[model samples]
Target: MDDVDETPDSVLAARARTGDAAAFGALVVRHQPAAIRLATIVGGSLDDAADIVQEAFVKAYRALPQQRDLVSATPLDPEAVALATTDAQLLIAALARLGERDRQVIGFRYFAGLTEAETATALDAAAGTVKSRTARALARLRQELDRSGVRGD
Candidate 1:
């Protein structure tokens, strides 16, 4: 296996976020099996799971931030991967607890990195409404994280 094949998923994702198509392709190749397994578990059909995984990856690619130099922003120590995985799991669980509207606003504003106006357009709401929803969603997400004993360090 080459260096890219041995690279961690978080590293690949970081590269993919920086507009590296090959890195994204590597990510898809590496994680496709697990993603398919997850889709199968949730969708209950292998055929449907493959379609769902494809769509999900497409959305994920679209949602990646346009500009972020995160890979070099923080040096990766041995514990970084474990910490990142734990934090991601915590955030995902917290998001799952949110109401649908709250989730949508958070996903659009943060996950998709859309401006309030853009989010407003996507949500069919006014910019002010999007702003309000984003604030409320953030508050709710904070509450969820706090309740889960996830501390920002």
Candidate 2:
């Protein structure tokens, strides 16, 4: 990890796609904090969630691209991901603004501790779609929080 702090995720992901192990590792390092927070929310008991989410996710192949793109697409900070991690009220307020399906997807995956397969079953969609939808839902939530001026420390 050379100073990847300033590097855009797109470049890191492209390099990762080409099997540049260093670049792949760099990408992982850059996204680790945000991704870990995601896993906790979308996957177990707040205390038990980290292990469950960590076990369920390893590569994040499907998610990495969108997450990478989201970095450029939104003004939300990695720190905002931490906002929901810190404040229950802010998370709920943001969640309330999402459409029904988005809210359900997040609720099922995170609040209810439903597996992607289980959530897909609940949503009547395929497993892959669940993953994609969850990613989009989270991005939207973060965007909403940012737009609404929710600050987390």
Candidate 3:
């Protein structure tokens, strides 16, 4: 443990990657002050900066093994774009005829991209209710779209 502080960051990082607790602690101790300082310069307060730094550290630690993998910066898939463009226009037209709650359910399910549980939380209903309501909303939307003759172009 003597002169452990003299270890280079690269060595510490390597050790940390291998699950060396002491080495990771050393790396954190060495880098955290700078991270906090940078966060503070951007975030405008000590409390906020500390919170940001802590979250960054946690995320960084969790992602350490996958750091070398390249991530897609733009997540909008072309297939999704094509489908949404063709069907969404007709769907939007149908949505306009539904009641407010039905519209909200559809919006939460599709446009807002909320999961059933999340939609339930947003609507303050049970998850099962959200699922059933979503089914009913889709059926209503289908009838509305059929009656309006809003075919996907």
Q: lDDT tens string, model 2, 40-126?
A: 444324554455445444445544454543324444577886765667656766776787678778977876568999999977999
Q: Which parts of model 1 have CA positions greater than 4 angstroms off?
A: 1-23, 31-75
lDDT of each: 0.78, 0.68, 0.72
Better of 1 and 3 by lDDT: 1
lDDT of 1 by residue, 1-153 (tens): 269978977788887897788899899888889777644543346896688678778887887886455566556786987988888778877877887788777866775567998889978999999998889989998999999999876
lDDT of 3 by residue, 1-153 (tens): 446789866677776776677877787788889666644443346796587677777776876776663333455677997977767556655676677678767766775457999989978999999999889988898898888665534
Compared with the true structure, model 2 gives a TM-score of 0.43
Q: Predictions ranked by lDDT, top down?
A: 1, 3, 2
Model with the higher lDDT, candidate 2 or 3:
3
